[model samples]
Each structure stands twice: as C-alpha cells, then as structure tokens.
Target: MSTATQVPELSVRVRDRLARRHPGALIGELTVLPGGHSGLTYSVTAGDHRYVVKAVPPGQRPVGRNDVLRQARVLGALAGAVEQVPVPGVVAVDETQPAWFAMDFAVGEAVEPVLDEPEVPAATARARMLEIASVLRRLHATDTRTPGLDAPEPLDAAGELERWSRTLHAVPPELRPGGEELLARLAADVPGGMPPVLLHGDFRLGNVLCDGERAVAVVDWEIWSVGDPRIDLGWFLLFADHRNFPQLGHAVPGLPSEAELLDAYLGDRPALPAMDWFRALGRMKMAAIMGHNLRRHREGKHHDPDQERLPPTIAAMIRTARDILG
Candidate 1:
C-alpha cells in the first residue's frame, strides 16, 4: 500500500497505545509529523489537549535513537526542574508493546535549515542563536542527578572520541581518508577536568521551536547524554562555520559567529580547557555521522538524495578538523 493510505493504519496503532496510557480520553487523529531523523513522530489530540507522540516503529528494537522512553526520561526530568529549561512537557507514556510517549505539542515555528532561511532577518536569526546559547548554558547548569537521567556516568573527552570511533570504523576507508590519523590525534591529547553536565547531544537552531524572536523550547533528545559541555558547545558552534556545510549556503547572514557563540555561552564563567580538541572532535563526529548516513543511503537502507551530496562535505569536515587540531 502507498504511504498515504498506510498512515491512518499506523495512526490507529499509536492511538490504541496512547489510549492504554490515558484511558477514557477521546483521542483524535495521530497525524504523522515530518522531519524526524529517528523514531516515529505524530501530532495527536485527545479531548481538549494536543500532543506530539514519539514511538519506535513496530517490530524494531527500541535501541539507540529509537528508544522513546529514554528521550522521555530526560524531558520528564527537565519538566520538573527548579530552573526551567525550555522543553516539552511529558503527558503520558506506554512502555509496553511498541514503546511510545506523548509530550505536550510545542507551539512555535520551526527554524530548521537555519542557514537557508533568508527571509528571517540576520539580526533576528543571530539573536535567536544567542538565545539558544543561553538556554544551553542553563541546561548544562542543571543537576545531572535530576532523577530520570539515572545518576549518569558522564562521558569524558576520551569516551566521546571512542563513541564516534565505532561509527568511523564501520564506514568505507575511502570515505574518510585521514580518519585514523584524526582519531589518533584526538585520542593522544584528550582534554580533561571539565565537569560533565546535561548535554543536548544535538544543539542547534533547527532542533528548537521558536516563538517570534525567542527560542521557546528545545526538542529532540534522542542522543542526549551527560558529557563535557563543550561537546555540545563545539557541535553547536560548527553550524556557524559555513565551510562545514557547503551544500547549505556560503554566508551565514545573521547567525552568530563561532566566537560570539562561545563568548555568549561562557559569559563570565571561568574558561574551561581550550576548545580546539573538542572542536576537532565535533568535526570528526560530523564526518563520521555523514559517512555512516552516506553508506546507509548507498546501501538503500535509508534512501535520502541529500546524503549523495555529503561526500565533499565529509572530506571538508575531516580536513577542517585537521586544521583545528594543528
């Protein structure tokens, strides 16, 4: 059956599970939401409320990004935080039979493909980016023992490198020329002593919901972990470097520069270790991610035409990482 015809059937499946969690409520249509890179998402309504539901596709192992419960745990913890971190509020969850959770549907505009939005004035975009940096700083300050995070063992700089290495080693050698050399350099001089905090994993304008000039909420917690804050800061800063994404655009008109972002994130707080290694590690991680996705695209496991254009970008990331490491 065509995808259009199948959505309703799939919606019914999710609705049934949601009904089990929120018994007696009259649930509405579970319309499939677009643009989730991992896990299944839907816009659902029950009684007078609306929600966004995330679930692992049926019969698929609920591991990695597909683990909706894990994402929910973070959201649930942040929801009750003494210092509010802008995030969705969890409403209900069902762990049995195709694990799924519902969060209050965030109401705001999505500023994804951040660089591609020319209509949004550069000042507005830059302001929004600065706002996001402040929010990230708040999240980093949140207690890691916030109940649902499981008293996490934070990943140090070395652990961060090893985590992405697994993905790097899985790809074709040709796709990542200086991959091993980069990994070795990163491993040799692992920066230490930064206390781990709640990391957004993927922190960028695209992952947030914005209302006017403000970043109202940060969404998508699939890879959230306890790690050196720079891991998130470095990754977030990389987006401002147009060289990393040649396919996106040449000039970032209004987006905050990397230095500006770092300054905003650091504020008056004492500086941690130099971010060069972390920056290099971020690029390496990006290259590995693009390489893995490119491999999957070619193998027809995940067919996205965009992945076809990533080879040059991947090469550029590795090259840039080397330059940063120097």
Candidate 2:
C-alpha cells in the first residue's frame, strides 16, 4: 500500500496501542516524518507527551532492513549505556499488527543541514567534525556484553564480501554484473583480521541529531552489528568523499578532509592500516543496497520517489568502488 493509504491506518493502530499503555491519553497531530528510504516514521502527540513512532509497512516483511523491533531493542540496550551520546528512551513497542515502536522524539535537527550551510564558519565546521569523531569513538569503545542485547554475528572480509554478494545477486539483472565483479575483486583481496567492535552500521551526519555543534542523539539503529570498527569509519569517509557522491561528502565547506577525519579518529593509535580496503567495501556495500531498493521500486514493492535517482547513483558508486579497488 502507498503512504497515502497507510498513514490513517497507522494512526489508528498507534492510538489504540498507546492508549492501552497510557489510559486517558489522547493522540493529536500525527504527521509523517520524511527523508528515510526505509520504514514509516510518524510524529505523534499523546496528551502532553510527544513521540516518534516507526513501523514496517503493511504486508511487507523487509529482509535485512528496517526491522523496527530490532531497532527498539538496540535503543533500549543503549539507553543508559553510553554517557557521551544520547539515545532516545523507549516509550513502547508492539510486535503484533504491522510491527511498530515508539521513542521520545529527539529535539534537534539532522547534522546534514549544518554541514551543508555555507555561512557557517570554517572553525565551527571543523569542530563539528571533531565532535562527530569523538562520539563515534565513544560508541565503538562501549562494552557490548549487556544482557538482552542481540549480538551481531561476527564478520570478516570474506564473510562481508559473501553477504553483500548475496544482496547483489538479488538486485535487478542490469546491476548484477558490476556487483558480482566488485564482490569478486573484494573477495580476492580481502583484508586480514582486525578486532571486532559494536558497529552503528549506517553512521553518518544524517543519522545524527545535533543541537548547535553538539550531537544530542544518534538515531536509527536497524543495522547495528558487530564488525570491524573501521567499517563505520570507512562509511563515514565515503559519505564525505566528493568523488563518490558530490551531493554528499565534499559539498560542505570547512569540513575536514577524509585523511584529517581519519587522523582525528586514530588519535594516538598507530594506524588504521586496512582502511582503504574497507572504504572500497563500504562503497560497494552501499551500491548493492541501493540496487536492491531499485529492484524493489521496479517490482512495486516499495514506493519512494527518491528511488528514481538510485539507478545512476548506484552506477556512480560502483564506478567509485572500482577506482578505489584499483
């Protein structure tokens, strides 16, 4: 079903489910929050409380993406776990009937606009990048032995290559060849062992909410996993690199260069020796994901207008991956 038809039904379900947990509460002004390619997000008001409700679409069981319950569990696990980064508290969760959960609405704008602002000072932009690096360091440094936390399966270079290869094969036929070639190259040159750490699988400016220069919260945990910490670092670098997507990484003036950001992350540590390999792998992984979404859009399984631009974006990502690999 399209978003136009889905919102009302989602509103009714949210109201009913929330009312059960909070008697005498009334929901008001439920509006759709935009910008995400997966999952349905709504801003809802109940009595004096405001919340963000996220749900999987009706009749669609998204494999390996947008799992609302899994996100809730991670949010819950990180609630009081990290002192430096803010994670929203779980308000409620319902696994039945469309699979949705609610969390306190974070009160800040996404970090993207800040990075994109031309009038912002160069020093301010550099400081913001440093702050982001600091938060990521904190997240990677957190202990992952908490109870009830769903530990992600261990992943090495070959394993990650195999995982994305399956995703590539599942994409549209037109995109498969390039994906296969990238996977093969990555498999052949797979980097050796690096210590695994808890990863925020899709970390970037867009996933972070900032108040002024400080990151108040890091939202979206659907892809949280256990893997090489440098994967997150490489993904962040890829997002900022203009060679891959001009609209993303290099658009904002005053931002740190990829090397500078990596230096800040590395700090006193000797080196991130496998970073280049992970960077290329990050681009390939992103291309495979976009290709899968493009396939879904073609089959009418998902309906995001932005998916129209993904074909060229995926092509560009594949090209960049090849250049990096070479």
Candidate 3:
C-alpha cells in the first residue's frame, strides 16, 4: 500500500458500520495518522467529538471483514484489567469500509523514534520510565484471561532457545550470520525463568508517549500478549539500555539510570550477569521481524521508510549481538 495518494478516504463499509452502531454521528478530526506496522489510523471528529479510526493492513484483510472489530473487542476485554498506558475506547468498530474501525482518540504525543530537533531531555525520560516500570509491574500482576494471549510457560533456557531459534530462522538466510551464534550462547545463559507474567509482544520505547518526560500513555496492541514479563523486560533492556545506546540516554534525560530502573523492576538487586544477552535477544528478534516485514516491501507489496530500513539495521543488529555476546 502506497501513501502516494490522499490515502483513499474511509470506504462506505466503515461509514455504514458507524451509522448503525453510532446512529447520529459524523467523523471529526478525520485525517490519516502517521506510523504503525499493521494498520492505518485516522484522526476523526464527529459532532463536537474526536475519534481514532483504525484498520488492518491493506493486504492481509481477513475473511468476513473482522480485524477492526476484533481489535476493538480485544482491547475492550482488556479494559481496566491490566496496567497499560491507556487506549481510546471503542466508538463503533466497522468492517464494511475496507477493513477499518473507530475509537475515541487518546490524547498525547507518541514518544517513539524521537520527537524532533529540539529534542526531549533524558532525566525527564527517566522519571517517565519509572512510571512505565510501575505500569508493567501492574500488567505482570494481572490475572485477566485474554484469549489473544497463549498460556505462560517457564522462560527457562530451553524455552528461550526454542523461541529465539524460530525467531532467528524467521530472518532471511542472507541475514542470518552471527545471529545464530549469539542465540546459541544466549540459549545456555538463562534468567532462571523469573515468575511468569504477561508479555507485550512488541514492547519498545517507540510504543510509548510522553508528556514532557513522563510516559502518559502506552499504545500499540496488535501483539499485546501473555507470557513472562521478561520478554517485555528483555526488550526494554535491549532497546533502552542507555549504556549500549548512550545517544538515546543522553538524548532523553528524564530517563532514569538503568540501574535505578532495573532495581525498581526487580524491587531489589538484579541477579543476571549479562544484560547484553537479553539485549542481543531483543536486537535479534527485531532484525528477524524486520527481515520478514521487508520482503513485503521489496516484493512491491508494500512501501514505507520504516519498513525499508530493515535490511541494513538487521545487519547492524547481528553485528551488535555478536560483539555483545562475545
């Protein structure tokens, strides 16, 4: 799907869905939103109201036009049950309009990939992160039985090995160099399966929002999941370990020091010897995800800068994993 044209306005199908569900309504602040992997978002306002219109990937449309409804249903089920940053409530999910749905727009600037030239401070970033840790702790403590997630398993050495091996294989063969070795070393290096908890499938700094250095909201639920919170933990440690990516730490000051945040996460001292292994795992998983995602772009199936950067970044991550694991 190309963004070349005036992103084909919401089709009649979505409009009809809204008409039936909402009765008297008109779309307000309705415009295409930027950034997302599987879908497009629209800023909508109807009759003194604003909402976010969501849809599934243009090509992977499901039979019976259900993604938009499915997404809203899943989120609704999770309401008040977990410790997420907060999302818009379902306004009226529609399936008729070319695979799209709608929700009241949550207010806040996305804190991902970096905001702009003026740049936000790191210390403020730290303070916000403490809030993030607190939220994750709440999620980890939740007992909601969401069907979207599979049951939790012990994140033992063997499980990590099996999981990453599959993730590594998902990477194109051309992109699989030192990744295997790093995964091998990491397979043996385990965290003793810290008590099971939910996993935010694609948790990352980019999925958050900041009101000055405090994370006011967390978005993105395509992969909201269940498993060891460690998956989310490992992802953050890899993606936000300011030590490995000092530029990020320095770039965002309110961000808490790694030690302080980890201590808070564990509510005590950390026992893992090498945070790098988890870092490697996170990087590898991203690289592999990128590889799978890029093929769609390369095959004239999709076009997006975010998707395009995968090949090279995948290589960079492989190298980083090898260096850190070695």
Candidate 4:
C-alpha cells in the first residue's frame, strides 16, 4: 500500500492490501459489482490472482450491519475448509477503517442466465445436488454460531410457519392471491422438524458459484442468519422443488426430483409434504417475499430488478400455489 499510489478511485484501500500480501501483489483493473442489498462489492485483480473486497459503506455501517465482521468470522472458522465444494477464503479483514476486508475469490460465474449444460448436467445435477445437500448437512450439524451475527432463532416446525406468515402479512391485498390458504395449511401441518442446523439465509441457484456442474461457493451472505434447518429446505424448493415446475430443470442435469430433494432433507427427521404440497409451499414462500418487495418498490422505495420482479413473480407463486392446493 504505497501512500504515494493510494488513489481513492481504485479502491485505494484494497489496492494497498494487495501490495502488502505479495509485495509483488499489484492492483490491476478494478470492477464494480452490484445486486447486493447492503454495501458495495468489487472484484480486484493483483498479478494473476483475483480477489473480492466487501466492506461497509463509509459512515453507513449501522450497529447491527456487521456483514464484513460476520464474513471474517465464518471464513476464518471454515478456513482451510476442504469439501468437495469450494468456499471463499478470508485474506484480510479490517473492521475499523473503510469498514472493509478482502478474500481469496473462487473462479466461476456467480449467476447464470439459465441452467445450461456447462452449468448443470441432468444426471450429474442430481448427484451434485445431493452433494450440496451434504454440504448443508455439515454446515448445520455444527453448533458454532458467529459472535456478532444475529443470535440463533427457533428452527422448529411452527416457527418456520410464523416466520413466513410475518413476511406474507407485509404484502398488500391486490398482490396477495391464494397465498393465505397455502400458508395456513403449511402452518397447521407442521412435520417433524429437522435438527437445528446452520441455514443459509438465502439458498438458491442464483447465489451459487459453479465450476461446471458443481457448486464452488455459496455467495452473498448479506442476509446470513442462524435458524431452522427447514428454512434452507423450503428455500431450495423455491427454485428446484417440482419436476415440471420450471424449464430450469431441462438443461440442468443431476437435479434431484422434488420428492428426492425433500426426502434427502427430511432424512429421519419427519415425513415431508406430498410432492405437490411441498411444491406449493415452496412457490408460495417465494411469491410472498416477492410480493413484499413488489409492494415496497411500487411505493417507489426499493428498485433492484430482483426486487422489481416481485409483483409478477408472486403471480407465478400464486399460480403454482393454487395448482398444488387446488
């Protein structure tokens, strides 16, 4: 970090750290990344290596907004983590200045426009999907909760229902269709809840970093929380639940059938919903969340495309919900 070359435009702080890591580590082309709910992310390259720097916005860091802090904790605890899957590494984290840190970046596209061959193989997709299931099993099996991140919450059957209910209630009328009945059934029929496991607050295809058909790293932790293991299961169904749900399964291989995924998740915990019933709840939750966001954006508040998709997205959630509940 040459005081002389520390130019603000190039993420001067990140530039300084790279130089320190390798002495030969030289900062090169800087790229800006968006789609994150909190703070900014940048891809910085030094020499032949690429790294991601995530930090709190200067002065925008709130008391509870400790993403930079939580990342450091998780990455450090899982440091030297070697699973079939890839995970990010924490190189340097600075909590004080710039509210920043850097990590060894995994090499793969973070988001795919659609599930394609290179991205997913139908036969292998199922196996790899199971691999992903194993990863979740391991992450949740551990009792370690990060210090600064939100404290653990109830992961039982009923809690998941109430949680989604709160999210659904936030949505306005015109936006909410058949979501109520779907939610009620899910609430009333609480199955044997899974053991309290580490839940990725947001688990979906879009957040995965893939090296060919396998998930290299699960990115985007701005919403990471410790809660019911079922949340992750429910979340996965949002995208990969039904066999004929979306054309998303065609090009993507090895994807477990909706029944398979649910069985794998429930394991010995409890019986799962009938394939159709599980599919309905999965889609309903997705819609409820989108409806909430759509409501916010309609009022001229939230503007992310992902958020903007809420209104229409929930319609699909409702359609699928009705089909399942009908």
Residue pairs with colliding backbones in model 1 are none
lDDT of 1 by residue, 220-278 (tens): 89989997888998888888857677675466476778888888888898765869898
Candidate 1 error regions (>4 Å): 1-26, 113-119
> TM-scores, in order shown?
0.89, 0.80, 0.72, 0.77
Q: For every model in order, what is the number of clashing pairs?
A: 0, 1, 25, 12
Candidate that beats the other on lDDT, 1 or 3, i.e. the better one? 1
Q: How much is the lDDT of residue 6 in candidate 1?
A: 50
lDDT (tens digit, per residue) of candidate 2 on 267-297? 7887777777888888888888888887888
lDDT of 4 by residue, 221-272 (tens): 6665666566676667655643333433333444566567666655676664
- Model 3 scores a TM of 0.72
Every model's Cα RMSD, please?
Answer: 3.0, 4.1, 5.0, 4.8
Task: State model 1's lDDT.
Answer: 0.83
After superposition, the stretches of candidate 2 with alpha carbons farther than 4 Å from their true spots are 1-26, 60-63, 95-97, 111-126, 169-182, 246-250, 292-316
- Positional deviation of 118 in candidate 1, in angstroms? 7.2
The model with the greater lDDT, 1 or 4, is 1
Best by TM-score: 1
